[model samples]
Each structure stands twice: as structure tokens, then as C-alpha cells.
Target: MDSQKRLARTAGMYYLIVAVLGAFAHIVRAQVYVPGDAAASADNVVAKASLVNHSFVADLVQATFLVFVVMTLYRLLHHAGKNVARAMVIFVVIAVAIICLNMIHQLGALLVATDPAYAAAFGVQGSEALVLLLLDLQHFGYLVAQIFFGLWLFPLGLLAIRSGMFPRLLARLLMVASAGYLLDVLLQFLTPELADAVNPVLVTLFSVAEGSMLFYLLIRGVRTLRPAEQAVLAA
Candidate 1:
């Protein structure tokens, strides 16, 4: 009904879209990627070329919508802390840039998997290896982008906590989620065996934290600022 509520809902809507599409793309990739078996992975990709294409499109769309999510949140939260809001936007921008560039690896994988010219030039075995390599690059590139993804949440949590318009508990959960993301990335890169053991818990934490924020923004919106709180923020 009011401008703040409208903006909150808009941000929630965009966030929801980005989440769904990103999940879809990830699911598709997981289905096709065979971990270490390049031939099997290539076969899977070739068999599901259409699905892979759709996933690529989903990833691009997700990246685009992610920008909207952060920008809308920035507009709504900027009054809480101008520098933190700007930092959130900057982090998202960097993440989005990495995501867009990362898509090239996905495209390369698809091309190497499906196009006859690649097979003819490189031989089937070689082409398949290239596909696997490209997909590997794409996966690691996403993790690199995720570093900023987690960093953005820290500033977002700070803004939410400072705003006096959202629950402090939820804001704190977001900060915890930020730490979870960073830790997940660290474990994934440094100690993958340990990461495999720990990642499920981290994923659950991230989901709970982000899911709570998404639902609150969509359903309850932000609470109205009290006159006293507004005066303090203005000062």
C-alpha cells in the first residue's frame, strides 16, 4: 500500500525469481555433470542439450534479476546507512559481472559437447575432455562469484539492523548466513573432503536465513519507522 512496502515487495519478488532460476540451473548442471567422468558427462550433455540450453538461459536471467534485487534493497535501505547500502550495491555489481563472464564457460562446454566441428577438429575424446574442463571452470567461477555474494549479505544485514524497521533477530541471522557462505567457500577450496561433510549444514543455514528475509519482505514488508527512530536516523 505504501512506498516502503511496495519497494520491499518488489525486492522480494526479484529475489524469488533469482533464487528459483538459479536453483533450476544448478539442478540441471548437477544432473549432467559426472564429477570425474568426462565421457559420461559429455554424453549426458549431448543427450540433454535442450535442457542445458535452458539452464544457461536461466543462469543469465538469474544474474540480471539479482541486480534488480540489490538495487531495490539499496533504495529502501540507503537511509539506514548510505555507505553500507552502497557497499551492498557494489558487491552485487561485481558478482553479477563475474556471473555474466562465467556463462562463457558454460557456453564453451555446450559447444564442445554438441557441435560436430569441435569433435572433428579435436576428436571425440578430446572434445569431451574440453567439455568437462569448461564445466569445471564454470563451477569454480561461480564459487568465486559467491565470495562477493556472501560479502553483500554482510552489508545488507548491517543495513537491516540499523534501519529499525526489521527484526534484529532476522538481521543477525543474515550476518550469520554471511559467515556461513564464506566458510563454505573456504572449505570447498581448501579442504574439499571436509567441505563435503560440512556443506549440507551450511546450505541449510543459508536457506533458512535468506528464506526468512524473503518471506518477511513479501508478506509483512518493513515496519513503519517511529518518529523518534526517524529523527535519530536523520541525525
Candidate 2:
């Protein structure tokens, strides 16, 4: 295949990886976490240690692959606008760093759940609370990372619009989705009660915006590149 197609496929592969792993992580967490019940959450984790371990590993893998996804996107979109592309990469890098760091809390939760030392020190109930607290930190850390996630999208959407390689409407919707991301993050931090209220709508928009881009890359690749661009890819 040609450069654009190759890049598209590669990106799609990584995106799908990230999506699958991320979904699995959420699924495992959901299986164990009772939202507000620490004791129940701990019991679930202890009982399903394998699932919790899998979730942490999945998260780490997803975060690592996300960096490659950002790099490939930057390579594809930089020609459209160097500054915006650079900004996009920067935001994604920061977000990835935050996400990777957040995984430590997941590890901490696992340790608190499984380690005998923690059990001895805190006792069962206290250990469960600590695990829940660590997981909560991971959740909040993700919210903070979402700020950079949203920032990256603005430039990505802008580049998509300007590049002429993608549908204009898709690009426009991406910007709208970016707004949703920003709004969601703000609500999460500023008015957490309101965050849950708007989460479904925002998540829907995000899924549409991102899913469209992913499908486009996987199915259509990009519009045929100019000769010079094709030459660069060949090199």
C-alpha cells in the first residue's frame, strides 16, 4: 500500500488497540467498583484480582500505544499546519505522561488489595478504604488528563479541516466534540454534581467524533496525496 494508506492502517490499528484496552480497563473497574462503597469495591477486587491486574496492564498498554497514535497523526497532519500539529502532539504527550503516572494509583490499589503488609497495618476494612481512595485518585487524575486531551483535539480538528484530506463536516463536529471535552473536564472539577448530568451527552459526541475519524482512517485512508507528499512517505 501507499504511504497514506499505510499510515492510516497503522494508526487505525493502534487506535483500535487503545480503544479495546481502554474499554476493558473500564469494564474491569466497573465490575469491582460500587461507585461509593469501599468495602464492596475491595471485596470485588480481592475476589477478582486477575481482572484488576488485567485492567492495570491494559491501561499501561493503552497509554503507551496512544503515544504512537499521536505521533502518526502528527506525521499525517503536520503538512496542513505545522504550529497546530506541534500543539496537538504536545498536548497528547502531556496527556500520555499524566495517564501513565495515573496508572501508579491503579497499581497502588492492587497492592493495597493484595499485600499482606497493608492488610496487617490497616486491617481489612481500612485496607479496602485505602484501595478505593487510590482508585479514586486514578479517576481524578484522568479528569486532569482530559484537559490536555481536549486541547489536542482543537488543533487536530483544525488540521483536519484545513488539510482537505477529511470531510469538512467531520472536522467541524470534531471541534464541537473538543468543546464537549473541555466542558466535561470543567464540570468535573468545578461542579462535579453537574458533571454526571452532562456526561452521557458529552461521551456520545466524543464517541461520534473520534469513531468517525477512526473509521475514516481504517476504511478510506486519506485522499490521494500530492506527488511530493507521496515521495516523503516513500522515503
Candidate 3:
């Protein structure tokens, strides 16, 4: 139980780091990216180059720490169901890989916006257009990664429920949040207009679910298992 508490706290700390950095990166992107306005987007990127760079670095760091978050979680939760825990880890790993690769598009956008060579080669308007295209690709790539992000939560929620460590309500909320993420991605790709309309609701759902889990882990950790529960887990 002591060890479990330690693991839970560690996972919470790592998750907090990932969440904060990820939010910062997203906020920066939202602030700088102007949809359908390539010239304006390029100008924003150039004007906020330092912030953009910092956001890029934040993303990389978030991705790196996400692995730590999941590995610790796997350790803490694997006793519930090894296969489920493994699935969760695999999903996070895939998401991390996709995120790292997606950053190349971000880097390309930055380079195109700031590098004089790109203007010389493609002209200013062309360079700006290329920047927009790369940013668009980066946006889509993030959605691709989000698919796995949502998937991992299913296994995690199941494990939490089975383990009897977390509140069942919280576990269910995580599963619902997982579905919400998938729905958000689908709507964004399939019916973008509707996606924009409901995005706030989806974001709120995610915040409530993930925030609850994080705070619980940080503040409450896992419940101590009874002897029978321990035996069952051993079995």
C-alpha cells in the first residue's frame, strides 16, 4: 500500500507536468494560428517566434513525460489486469510517437515563416501559403494522435474500476471522457461545423474527467485493499 501510494503520487506528478505543458502548447497554437489566413498566420508566427519556439519545446517535453506518466500508471494499475494495463501503455506509446513526428510539421511552419531563404525560393506569398499548409498538417496530425489518446483511457478506466482503487464514478467518467474524445475527433473530421459548435462541451468534459483523476491521485492516492481483495489480486 505504501508503495502503491508512492507510485500513484509519482504518476500524478508526471501527469500534471504533461497536462500543464500540453495546455501551454495548445494555447500558444490557438493564439498564433489564424485559420484561412496564411499571411496573417505567418505574421503571427514571426511576431511570436519566441513563444512559438517555447511551445514547440513544451510539446516535446510533454510527449517525453507522457511516457513516464503511463509507465508509472502501468506499474500502479497492472495488478488489476495485466493485459488492460499493457493496452493502455501501448496506446500512450503510439500517441507519443505520433506527437513527436507531428512536430516536424510545426518546425517546418516555423522555418518557412522565419527563413529568408524560403521567401527567396518561393516568394513571400508562396512561403506564407506553405506555412499555412504545414500548420494545417500539424493540426490534422494532432487529431490523429488524439485517437490513441482517447483509446488509452478506456483501458485505464477499466483498470481503475476493476482494481477497486479509484471511485467507480470517476472510472465511469474517464470512460465517458474517452468516448467524448473520439466523438470530438470524428466530428472535427466528418462534420467540422458541428464540431466547432460542441467543442466547448467536449473540452469541459475532458477537463472534469481528467482533472478529477489527477487531483484524486495527487490528494487521495489509491484506497487500501482488504485482505480478500489482495488475495484476489494475487490470484
Candidate 4:
């Protein structure tokens, strides 16, 4: 395969890995997590320990794959705009760091939910409460990461626009998705009631936005530029 084709396949594989594992983890989490019900959430975790373990493992592996996705995307786009590519890497790296660090909270919650010692120390009720608290930390920390998640998209979208290898609509949609992400996080933090009402719509839009680009990369690879365009990209 040529460089573009090789890079596309690598990125496509990583994207697939991240998406599949991420969806799996999220589905498991949603199945077990009872919003605003600490006792119920804890009970669910304890009852479905194996499933929760799967979720955690999937999340960790997905995150690891995402590092490759970012690196590959950087290599693909850096020729179009170096500074923008660097910004994209920086934002994604920050987001990844936050995500990896936040997993400890999830792990802590799991330990508290499963260990008899924790119950002995804090009592069953207190232990459950602690588990809930830790889980909440993980959730909110995810929101914090979303800030960088949105930031990375801006530069990525800009690069896509300049590269002339992607559809202009794709670039526009990415920027729109970035706004959606920032808006979702802001409302979720500042006006949670409103966020609850509207977040699903925003999430769907964001998914579609990213999904479009993902499918394009997988199916089309990067467009082969003409000599003039290549010169511009190199410059």
C-alpha cells in the first residue's frame, strides 16, 4: 500500500478499536449505573461484578488504542498544517491523560464495591456511598476531559479544511461537533437540568459528525492530491 493507504488503514483500525470498545464499555456502564441512586448503583456493581470488570478492561484497552489513533491522525494531517496538528496532539494528549487518570476512580469504586474490608471499615451503607462518590468522580472527570476533546477537534477541522483531501462539509461538521461537545459539557456542569433534557440530541449530532469522518477515512482513504496541491501542502 502507498503511504496514504497505509496510514488510512492504520487509523481506520485504531478508530474501529476505539469505537467498538468504547461502546461496549459505555453499554455496560449504562446497564449497571442507576442515576442518582447510590444504593442501587452500588448494588448493581456488586451484583454484576464480572460485567463491570469487562467494562473497565474494555475502557483501558480502548484508551490505549486511541493513542495510536491520535498519532496516526497527526502524521496524516501534519503536512497540511504543522501548528494546527501540534495543537490537535496537545489537546488529545491532555484528554487522554485525564481519561487514564480518571480510570483510577473507577477502579477505586470497584474495589470498594467488591472488598469485604471496605465494608468492614466504612460499613455497608458507607461503603456503597463511597463507591457512588468515586463513580461520580469518574463521570465528572470525563466531562473535564471533554473540554480538551472539543478543543482538539477545532484544529483537526481546520487542518481538514486546508488539506483539500477531505470534504468541506466534513470539516464544517467537525467544527460544529466541537461546539456541541463544549456546549454539552458546559450545560451538564452549569445547568444540569437543561443538559439532561438536551444532551442526547447533542450527543447524537456529535456522534454523526465524527462517524461521517471515520467512515470516510475507512472507505476513501485520503484523496491523492495533484502536484499543485501537494506543493501547497508541503509548503
Residue-by-residue lDDT tens digits, candidate 1, 21-136: 99999999999888789999999999999999999999999999999999999999998889999999999999999999999998889989999999999999999999999989
TM-score of model number 3: 0.97
Estimated TM-score for each candidate: 0.97, 0.92, 0.97, 0.95
In candidate 1, the residue pairs with backbone N, CA or C atoms under 3 Å apart (3 or more residues apart, or in different chains) clash, namely none
The lDDT values for all models are 0.93, 0.87, 0.94, 0.87
Best by lDDT: 3
The true-structure Cα RMSD of candidate 3 reads: 1.1
Tens digits of per-residue lDDT for model 2 on 1-235?
A: 3786788778888998988999899899878877678998788888999989989999889989989998998888898889999999999899999999998988888889889899899888899899899888888899899889888888988998777677888888888988898899889889989999999989999999989988888988877757885666456
Write candidate 3's Cα lDDT for 1-235 as tens digits.
Answer: 8989999999999999999999999999998788899999999999999999999999999999999999999999997889999999999999999999999998999999999999999999999999999999999999999999999999999999999899999999999999999999999999999999999999999999999999899988898878997788778
| Candidate 4's TM-score | 0.95
Better of 2 and 3 by TM-score: 3
lDDT-wise, the better of 1 and 3 is 3
> How many clashing pairs per prediction, in order?
0, 0, 0, 0
